[model samples]
Target chain A: MATTAGERESSLWVILLTFAVAMLFSVVSLPEFIPWQLGYLRPQWVELVLIYWIMALPHRVGIFSAWVLGLFVDVLTGSLLGQHGVAFIIVAYIASSLYQRLRMFAVWQQSLIIFVTIGISQLVNFWVENFVGLSQWDMRFLLSALVSAMLWPWVFLVLRHLRRLFNVS
Target chain B: MIGLTLLSIALMVVDHLSDLLDEVRSGLTVVVTPVYIVADYPNRAADLAQQMFTSRDGLQEQVISLEEQLLLMKVKTEKMSALTAENNRLRDLLGSAAKLQDNVLVAELVGVDPDPNKHEVVIDKGTQHDVFVGQPVLDAEGLMGQVIEVSPLTSRVLLISDQSHSVPVQVVRSNLRLIAQGTGVTRQLDLMHVQGTADIKQGDLLVSSGLGNRFPVGYPVGIVTQFKHNPSEPFAKATANPSAMLDRSRYVLLVFTEASLREPVIGAEG
Candidate 1:
């Protein structure tokens, strides 16, 4: 059966809204807040939003979109050109491919998986960076992934409303 | 599927063409700057309100004391100028050109990266004001970071406290050179590749060794806070607290050198 017109419209809205949120999230804060900063609690708002959209509407947010988003992030964050694009494409594919299994898990369980996905993404980022002859490792990578995972629930709730507003299923 | 494959291949090629893409990157920076400004308006208003509501007496006292300190520092600096001139003269005689970076344009700190793993700051300066990628940023006390992304009227800086940030620095005490990398936590920096027997200690000041040529020489970067020599390993792990107040800087300076714009990254003492 064909998807409902409302669902299709909502899907487009969700993807665009998510992209805006990711862009804003990426540029909004300098990592200077919070005292005694734990490395695990870093916010991966973009990845979180991307995962949500990819799972919610795989048809709209696909490999090409993820790659473009990652490219923008690369420019925004000043990483090597393809560094974020590669990581994002990998994470987007992983999250989307496993969406069926992931959707069935409890919220907490899903957060754990999200954490792992982002953690793996960071590792991939580190690996590619090193391969490009820019190798430097610090504990913050794991910490940021963990923290971003922890924040997934709240992010999901917020983005879900945006999805509703945009009429995305 | 073939179309997608072709698109991916095209993107991969464009991604590898870093040098050729600088113009496009710079152009994109110009295009999205307005978005950042609109998003940052609320935060700026809140900060302004907070500053306006601060206790009058507190603000007055701060200004008075700061002026006094500045006067004292000015007197001391005057005394050191002649000595500096003599040092420069000697260096000039030795055929070493004195490399001086221009003073930076002060930029407002609009936002911090929401992610703690990536220590970055968005500043209100961009290509519109001639700020370019790789411009050195400085907080009141010392080195902060470099501009990594330039939107038309805004730019993002990667702070020295980010894991991705690294710089070549020399221990003020021993002049031992090492690469200092960010630990992704505010105020913490780690020096890589120091043997256990190295003559570095806690409280040692690390200055930009000027060897990297990316950063101007003689700026304070950080102070060694922890030094551990593991008997099991040949290398010692050292951490420094960045002198730049990354957490509190409301205003920062972005130093741009027109001459160094296209210059290669200089490798300094390792």
Candidate 2:
């Protein structure tokens, strides 16, 4: 039984590591990595992970984690200080707020809502950057939102498998 | 918490007082570099493996041709160094560090800001590598913007073509200095505060004048694409395409120095 607990703990670490790696991958926007316009079609991998953890183990992923991740992103991306923090917090809040409703929705419906949430998050990112005086205002900004929406189903399935593996009852 | 906010505010004040923020940003950037490298490793390896497995004869031919081009460039660079030494000698007589060009660290762009209005990009190098804010960022061709923030291993560069960004530039052919501001269009720069009678024209090259002591002097900034002047209006409506390879850059150089700390006063127009 103690071994089983240890295994479970290790698995949890694995999950967190996977999430961090995924975030890093999503963050590194090499030109021509995606077939679309350069750096335009980045999927909101951070938002996907946020939604997954919120849906699977709502207790572990919370407002503070979301805020900190946002800060990391802000620091990494070099935007205004709190811009990603503001967006991530709002996205997590909305995801958690709609958690029960989201679980009941079909995969596509859930994905749509996720799309809108990530879209709004991107918009807020745009807003804060512009307000802090870094506005670009190009249509390519919509690319990430679209890509994130499309990837939602795959992310959902992956989270479901991880949940079962962990036996998150 | 409000306490955290107050603390951050205090840190901001202290940072301004003692320039401690650069140290903190540099430390954070160092820490993040490993994370970015670890994440990039697997994909990069897979790419290398794939390249080894399937490179073709045509590609090899192209590589040989590219090598020839590179050899030509090396010869040109040798000549450039001789001219640069002569130019430095002249500049020394004029009194100043010859406006040493910013020593730029070439960094792979990792990400773009997740918004349309915010034209920012994340580069792999950060403050740990000695990158500083106010340092100009550039793509292959021209000015992109400045280093706005830095993490331990990464830094963000604000592109000059973003709506909220602006830089001091001079018309190369006519020497008409003006502040070129971004309009969020990502395609053009709006030259601000120029009079209708200002000696400006289409196809003029804009270069950094190094007046603010922020960006190094003489980097190609943009080119005049269009001009609109109304007979009654005080200023001419002019736009220039930013010289930076804004839409196509995958790597950027962060220039981290100026010739002086004090702003250079405008010399009388020759």
Candidate 3:
């Protein structure tokens, strides 16, 4: 789609606002604020947000942004630096490369793809965490991937609505 | 992609092997602190509103109970003064230096580590408040953790239950010293290298030995909750529940003790 000068300028603002809100969601939805027993069920909000943006506007949200955002998440969570950065870059690359095909899929199929993408990211994270001896082999780490997959349809709809409202394209 | 992955690996290795990236992490933390403040706003607002709407009768009842507890504490402190003087005399007789009382600053928890595998928290106090890495922290009950990273306005605490953390502890009843390692589980620590014949028992109070100088001596660390001695094994496995409420504490005390003021030897704990 061709964009006018005004549309391009407004798209920049919309992108920034969406990313800021996503970061806010990642920070505010930490499991610490919830009951301790249910901490393992916390969804990967930042990952899901990255996936949605990359899928929607592959040309705009690319690998560099993913890497930087991952670093922000790492520092925010006080985890090993670069752990999330690598995972995010991989996820962003896959989403952008598959964006055309992804757009044609149903919401449920897209969620299944999200499950695979996030699961891959989680695996990368687990591998790095294991390399540094920071994490053990536990099946519970995959729970976030499952939860993120479950939430993908709603997230996709909300972001789609906001994108249309702002003429983000 | 490969180049970027390689760069990230290098960053991680550099971060783990030295203090080179600490300054970078602290600088980035300044940018991220606002996110945490914004995240905490709703909870803080609710607390404020709750306080404002509390009934006067309820406030009065709370004040009365607090005053009664204060009175009881004052009586106990009066007795403590006499015991302290006698203890000082005994130390002098033994030609040992008198223990200096530690000064403490109260700090509120600002953020908690989101990773379920890691037990850590950030506090409001930081380098500006004279908070240093390795400074011991405590809640009302017992030792909580030590500062691992300090930024300008905040610091990160590695809790005693973190997988990477270990503390030297001694049994109060038997005076047997052992190392307690964090099991990555809340309120639990594993005593490492304990012999099956060791005199540890259930409910034995474990206190910091102050041998490594990382933590101050005689602070309650935990109480033994389980001891298993398998005849086939060379060492007994024992676990203790930490005295501090690692999961529930909201405020903690930063202790400025004389020993902690000394420079911490790098890689000393290993």
Candidate 4:
């Protein structure tokens, strides 16, 4: 089980690549002029990616990295600074605590957890936005969670493959 | 975990309740800009591909039509010079403010606010380009918005159609002062505190009144599309279509007011 330095370095790079792709997707909306009702379809890409990494490597990608990632997201999205940081910290805390059970569950059941975790994260966003008087309808929170849950299986498979390919463990 | 979460909450509260995080946010914006620039490549590429694939005949037709439109606009503006001189003379008689032509810089819309709750766009121009906060932005049609945040390489614009945004406007026909509030819809604006007996009609024009001095005077704001009077409500209801294409325009002009122009030595930066 002698892992070379190159492999270890590559594992970090792979994780970064996933996060970068997620950030890119998080900021982009297809067609750019979508109506308000259709906005929930824009899945929380950064949160999804963070969930996968924390689940896969609970020791390596823990609360600190999640907070840093969330800070970047806050800047990228132009929200109140550290708003996403709060959400990501909470999600990371929950995901690491439940990582074993999450790994043991079926894909469908894993989505249920994702639904709750992402919903919790979106709740933080919703609450912060409301506090700042940038309120949207309540439907947006639930619909965004549903959409993120629906995308969980695909996101898990892809990240797992990348982890396996790069030996991220 | 608790410590970090507390830090996050503290950061949010401080950022929201005070200007303590403005400098921090601006510094971070410089770092995050590269990701947005990379993400925006697809849109720029799509535009280029469309231009590359367009038929030569189609481009020729477009150029011809644009030239004709330019000619028509030139004819319309030909009388503006005389009118401006007359207006200036009348203003001089009244001891009003001088209407010096504003220097404007062109900027391209680079990225949009990721949140659906806000109507904001990031433009390519920034403090590097002398794009300061509260600077007025415009398209060829009319006033679009004002700059709210300025970083070194980019600035954020709060569009006139945001629910939180409002512009002081006056009716063109009756010269009655009113306030136009954004309805969170790009095509509509609500005239607040309108009296039931107000003279606003379906086609009346609205212009910036320059009362707050955010937007310059006489720029078209919107054209009234609907008005209603209800005895139950305290104020009459009226809505107008925004003159600028809030959701459509890709390029906008950033205006440098006379007050801001006095700071930097004119020949120093240029």
What is each predicted model's overall lDDT from 0 to 1? Answer: 0.75, 0.72, 0.85, 0.85
- Residue-level lDDT for B85 in candidate 4: 77
Where does model 3 exceed 4 Å of error?
A1-10, A29-35, B92-100, B262-270
Q: CA shift at B10, candidate 1, in angstroms?
A: 7.0
lDDT (Cα, tens digit) per residue for candidate 4, span A1-169: 8778888887898899899999998776446455754655788888899989888898789999999999989888778888999999988998999999999999999899999998999998898988888876666667788888899999999998888877887
Question: Whose lDDT is higher: candidate 2's or candidate 3's?
Answer: 3
DockQ of each: 0.26, 0.27, 0.55, 0.68
Best-first order by TM-score: 4, 3, 2, 1
Query: C-alpha displacement of A138 in model 3, angstroms?
Result: 0.4
Give per-residue CA lDDT, model 4, range B128-236, as digits (tens). 8767889889988998999988889999999899899999999999998999988777788999999999988999999999888788888899999999999999989
DockQ-best of 1 and 4: 4
Per residue, candidate 3 scores C-alpha lDDT tens digits across A104-130 of: 999999999999999999999999889
The 10-residue segment with the lowest total lDDT in model 3 chain A: A29-38
Residue A5's lDDT within candidate 3 is 87
The local distance difference test score of model 2 is: 0.72
lDDT of 2 by residue, A1-169 (tens): 2346666676677566756776686655453345434456778887888888876666667667777777666555554445666777778888887888888999899888987898898898776555444444656677788888889899889878877776643
Each prediction's TM-score versus the true structure: 0.71, 0.75, 0.92, 0.94
Chain B TM-score of model 4, please?
0.92
Best by TM-score: 4
Candidate 1 chain A worst ten-residue window by lDDT: A30-39
